[model samples]
Target: MNPETIRRRRWYILGVLTFSLLVVVLDNTILNVALKTIADPQEGLGATQSQLEWAINSYTLVFAGLLFTFGVIGDRLGRKRVLVAGMVMFGLASLLSAYSQSPAQLIGARALMGLGGAAIMPQTLSIITNVFEPQERGRAIGIWSGAVGLAIGIGPITGGLLLAHFWWGSVFLINVPVIVVGAVLIALLVPESRNPDPGRLDPVGVLLSIVGLVTLSYGIIQGGERGAWLEPGVLGPIAAGLAVLALFARHEARSDHPAFDVRLFRDPRLSAAVAAIALCFFAAAGMFFFAGFYLQSVRGLSAFQSGAMLLPFAVAQILFSTRSAAMVHRFGAKAVCATGLLLVAAALASYPVLGIGTGTPLWVLGAVFFVQGAGMANVMPPATESVMSALPREKAGAGSALNNTARQVAVAMGVAVLGSVLASIYRGELAERLAALPPGARTVAAESIEGAHAVAERLGAAGQGLIGPANAAFTEAMRTAAGAAAVIAFLGALVVLKWMPGRTAHREPERAERAERAERGTGREKARGRRAASRERTRV
Candidate 1:
């Protein structure tokens, strides 16, 4: 009843939200390390390039595809109800993922997990919008955003440790207990909230959206892996995906109750927020995807070791997440976003040089990741704040969902694009280096390199001398790949800076109303905390 009691309860609510988010985010990153393990279980899953691609992209594809629809579902049904339902589904999917017998099976299970993720992911931000006040919302969202960074930050390390001790399935299994605890706490403490006049579900719009996203995602995913844009297999899905998206757009424009108001593009703040989500995640996902290879293939780190090496990134993000919010409030999202993107670009560019040797100095890699992490810290929270602040209270679910969808889509595309680039360069460079060798040596080299081996076997004593040059070539190629990706990300920052609305002198009534909802959210957060503490005490 009292403010003090409410404050205590607020933290408990954040705990549940954070825990749920951890499951979603951890799944996203943990798979980065587990990919090799899952693919090549005996000599490390020996997963083909295509299979590896699917392992990462399948979850993202499903996550991105269903985000908008589930967001609407949350609005129409209830955010809490949707989240609880999603958690149950996600837990079951995780179990399925653990038992996967093949890469195809794992990919299928991951897709199912994404389906649940689509339902679970948006609520975390929407709830902050639902509960926290405007002034406090910025800070609350910062903390919420930080939790995401933490999950990503720790994912590799945690996954590596689990993999080292158990099987690849352990990473998925870890989500089980966390989700169970989160579900109970969320049910008890978080209040049921939804749109007051939720719009009707637009099946036509949903169909279009699904078609467009699937097509678009399939194109990028396939093109990136195969290193050719015109491959019929790649182009077919992309073309169909685009055609379906175009139809979806037309339907949304005409529909009475569109799945989303496509007209929101008119709002610079919303547009910038959407673009920022796309670009930021594009860079972030690329870094995560490639860094795994750099650490494992190039640097010769174990899965656990590579995950540990990423600590600087996680630590920097957690340290600066709240600070990023303050900077956004002071300088505005556009300035903060621009600065962040520049830093990310710089970090990406640095990779080519820093990626060179097996014994790369820890401080050098750490510094680069720290800068990238700081940028990431800025980009994520500021972008979320921009979108949530741009919309009315009633539209938070849809808005948040849209923002998250962009991110999911970007992540999938980035990995496909950047991952493809990295793979191609690595393969081509390896091929060229092997070209000078004898027939048997070349065969051994190609097979060995394809399997992530740093050096070939048949060359023996003579080949040992060539490892330095080959490694250098591969690193240089990755550098080129990473740099190009960075340029695209920087361009994304520019789009945000030029497009988002300028900060006003005063907060609007809608902003104030949103702030009030945020306060109520804080109340619910407190309620959840009290219940969690009580449970702890009872257990004691």
Candidate 2:
């Protein structure tokens, strides 16, 4: 086959893979708006704070726990087969989630969906690696990465629109058509690909990793709400989780066919790109997660309203992301990424100051996110392109998995770390501010922020007087949390600037060469056609 033919086929494959990933990415943000509606049908199913936590965390736990194992399985079985099977599982789980009778059932179904997601996400990039020649892979990855931002942008709007018009179950139900369409297209279009030197799956490694991640996540989630950091309930799981993770690392080093690829970190560009993924996820996840609460609880926006409020971030991400490849080509990795990080930090830092009054203009909030979104658009695509393009072609499965694993770990940790920061400040501020009030009022104010209505019920008439102080205290806590988030964002930026290479090395350089050749080929084709037409006229 001609080079041009091969290039066209590769792009077609990329489309199928992108569709597969869209399911996983959409799931991540779709639940944000539906949480209240899902938990509170018929005036609410009496869902508790813990249940709400599990609703979100359950999906992440299973997804993160199984990612490495599934990656290896994809390498062993074939990415195409694994991707199909995963889509089926995801569809089934979504149906079950819609029918969940209680919070437990919903959480359980969501976990199942996560398992399916783990199967789906890694294969998209791996398939891109399989199909695209090295030179074109960066551009392909740029489009793939942009699709993620697109899914997120669409998720909130879709979720809100559905939830407002239909039921909470509508969110999960919406996935059905998408899955069916993707499955049909992939079945017809995508080809099978797998690892050349496939190895045995390590069950021990999977067990240890899952246990550790779950325990650590549990501690973080609970610590934020219940002050479990000071108690055995929080510390025990966290400590145990770390111990298990340590054991897994040691075991991987000793194993002949380890599930996790410890060797991928040996490459400087790959390592830097992975770290950037972690940081990108950490800041992005934290900002979005808390931004939900800030809109609803503090700003008094409803689910639909909050979803609408996130438009600036979503719009900017979609609009700017398509141009990321050109920007990377122009500015280089270090300059573009550093600029993105700084913008993100500035936006996060502005959150606290803006939280000061009830009259905070919606336009100002939107403007901050618009800038933040544009910065993020610059950072993610190049970083992802760099990482996937650096790996040897055969190692695509493992490399893609590792890239995603860093993102998942960062996402889980963000909820724990940044969520705890916000929760701790809120609890402390509330305690101090409410101290002089009546004992009952103080107790009412101390209930979980998730259950703030309970506190209002307890306060009775006295609640009116305390509202001003409580509002002031909550504003102060939000400001403090945003300040901390700013530091974290800045640190993430510094890491990107200091570590990620200004130029692509190894596979990346080769890919660039190929793109130049392809461009030359197109020019030659045009010139040949012009000469042939002129000669034909002379002959006539």
Candidate 3:
């Protein structure tokens, strides 16, 4: 092919990657706007708090657990081939999720969707990592990471529109056509690629990782529901999960060919990059998790209005994402990433302090979202560039999987952990306050904010009194949850500043090669000088 055509194809390849990726990424937060509708007992599936958590967590848990397994599988198989198959799987799973009647069935379908997403996510990044050269990789990754914000932006809006017109199922169903189009584009435009020397499949590692993630998530969800960490339901699974993950580590530490190398964390850049992305997502997930209810339930905004309200965040994300690659080059990953983390920390910390009421505080809250969006935009693209640059092309799949796994795990925990904190506080606030109601009604009211609203609706004018206290209680819970997410983000900022490499991160190889050349030159000079000295001695 001519140079011009080849150059153009690469960007076309990027387009293909982004669309396929959107199919997976959009589903994650798309359901957030629809959660209220889904939990409506009259018009939709009546899912409880635990079940609602599962709706999101099931996808993330399975996605996180299987990422490395499938990454390796994709490396052994053809990336393009596996990608097509994953798209097919994702489409089918979305159909199941869209049609499922019960919460359990929806969860199962989401899990299947996650299984397909696991196959897709790593390959997208790994392919970009391999295809793009060092000079261009940052820009490529920036555009790639931008797609995430795009998905997040479009998800709520599209979900809101769909919910306004159609059933909750339409959100999942929409992915089918997108995935089909993406698959066709891939078949035509994308090149097949994989690791030539991919290692043997690690069944033990896969089993351990899957079990560890599932159990860990289960524990957190259980703890959130029960609000007791010491109970068997919480402690047992947590301990078991930790133990299994530890074993998985030990196994990797000893293995000749580890599925995902634990040693990558030895490089502070990669580790810190992973940490930064995970924590940012943690705050983002928690924010959106409550923002949905806070907007629709407490503030009385329609889902479409809520989606519109979030436009500032999406716009900020887009603006910053466009500039992040250049910013990374200008400021370097360490500084850019650290600053971004601090902004997210500040935004989150302000969450509780800022009121949801439509006044000056709400405007302040929008400003915070704008800043936080810019902050996240700075973090992911640079962090991805840093991590992918650190790895050799051959190991891109594993490295990408490791990076993505951290992100998926963080997302799941974001919902599970932060949601747990929110849940506990929301439930506690309602407990004694809700005690006045009948046993069944009180229990239902205390289960979730949505349930409280439902109970209030059912009780007629008498329940009108409950809205003030319930919303206030829920808002208080949100503040506490936001505070916790802030702390995590702040800590991540510290980690980035302290551990991540500076402007010279990209030039390390050139620096190393220069040092070797200098040493060789010095050796040659010494050898010449010694020979001259010996010749002079012989003449004497």
Candidate 4:
């Protein structure tokens, strides 16, 4: 009955949601370390590179494709109900993934896991939006957002530890207990919430959106690795995907009961926040994706060793994020977010210039990653709080879906576009160096860093000279990607500063008025408080 009790309950609910989120986000990063183990010749599935790639991409493709559809479904039915179903589905799928005997089976299981994730992800934020008051929304979202970075930062470590001690299936099996625990907490603590006027689900809109997103994601994933950006296979699907997306937009604009609202983008704060999230993901995803290669290939760190070294990234976020909401409360989202993005940009820019041959490069990297993690922590919560604040309470589910879908697409694009840029640069640099090698060896050397290593092994001591040029090429590509990522982060910062409004427009004034009335003990204040309390009681 008291605000204090309700506040504590809210925080407890937040913890459950954070744990649920850890399950989903961990899947995104945890599998990366286990992929080789899963694909090993003797102990695991003898999966080809394509199969291994699909193990990751299939989940992404299905997840990104279905997010908006599931968000709407959750809104129309009930968020709590959908979220519970998702947990069950995710747990069962993880079981299947753990027991998969073939690459096809694992990929299929991952796709199912993604489907469950689509249902779960949007509901977490939307539920928080419905329950928390405006004043506390930022802090709630800050904790939730911090879970993402924390999970990501530690996922590889967790996976590495598991793989080092257990079978490859242990990674997938790990999700089972978490899902069971999360589901129990969800059923007990998380309140049901939904859109009052969710309207009918637009089947055509779902179909179009799914096709577009899936096709686009496929092109990006395949194109980045195969260097098929302009090829008909990649280009054709990409064009079709864009056209379908445009058709979906046009159709939604004309519909009386659209599946999701596109007009939300008209709100500059929401638009800017979404953009900021996307750009930040683009940078972070690309950075970590390739940085693994650089650290292992160029610096010669073992997988577990590299993962241990990245622990500070999580530590920085976990330490700083709880306080980020306070920063937003005091200095406002615009300033805090701008400073954070600029910090991320500066960190990205510093990566290329740090000399790898020097003794201090690892320390420099640790410092840079910590700064980058802290920056991302600041950016996520404040920006998300601003975005969710802009939407009507009834549209929270669909709106949250839109926000997440934008982020998922940005990561896919980052892996594609930034990766393409890096690959192109590496190929160009290696081309000159590989010219004198045998044609077969040149072909292998030019493909990837691993391929170059294989070529060097085949050539024996004669190939020792190739390692220098290969490392040089990879380093140059790192510089190019990081430089571009810096530009992206800086642009995001500028957008937040220029477009995202401060508390003048977003913060509620009633709380301050209520405080003053309580302090002064006015008769009218008491009367109004009784009425307000009654209304809150009825709502609760």
Name the best candidate (by TM-score): 3
Tell me model 4's lDDT, rounded to 2 decimals: 0.80
lDDT of 1 by residue, 1-540 (tens): 344554567766776887888899998788887765664537455566567777778888778767777878898899999999999999999999988888788889988999999999888778778777676778888898889888888999999999889988898998899889989988988777888898777777766776677677767766755656788998898888888888888887788787756887787787887888798788778768767766776677799998898888899889989787788767777888888888888888887656645667867887887888888888888888888877888888878888888888788888777776765666576666667777755543443233434234344676675566556655766687778878877898889778865454224544667888899999999999999999999999
Worst 10 residues of 4 by lDDT: 352-361
Ranking by lDDT: 3, 4, 1, 2
Candidate 2 lDDT, tens digit per residue, 1-540? 345554667777787788878888887687776654554436344454446666767787678767777878888899889999999999999999888888889889998998899899888888888788665666788788878877776787777787778777778888888899998988887878789887788888778877888888788777876755879888888898899989988888888877676776777667777777677677767667656556766677877787887788878887878787777787777677777778878887887756644568888888987887887787777777777767667878777888888888877787667767666666787775567666764544554343443455556875555555555555666677667767777887787777777854433586667789989999999999999999999999
Which candidate comes out best when scored by lDDT?
A: 3
Candidate 4, position 441, lDDT: 84
* TM-scores for every predicted model: 0.87, 0.88, 0.92, 0.88
Candidate 1 lDDT: 0.78
lDDT score, candidate 4, position 277? 89
- RMSD of every candidate to native, in Å, equals 8.4, 5.2, 6.3, 5.0
Per-residue accuracy of model 4 over 1-540 as CA lDDT, tens digit each: 355665669988898899998999998777866654564546678564446556766776667767777888888889999999999999999999999999999999998998899889999999888778866777889999999889988988898788778888888999999999999999988887778887677788777877887677666655655654788888888888899999989998888766656777898989999999889888877777666667766787766766776788899889878889888778888888888899899989886766443234587788888999989988988888877877778878877887788777777667666766777778787877789899988866776665686678789999999988898888888788898999999999989888988766555543664686678777778889999999999999
| Residue 123 C-alpha lDDT in model 1 | 81
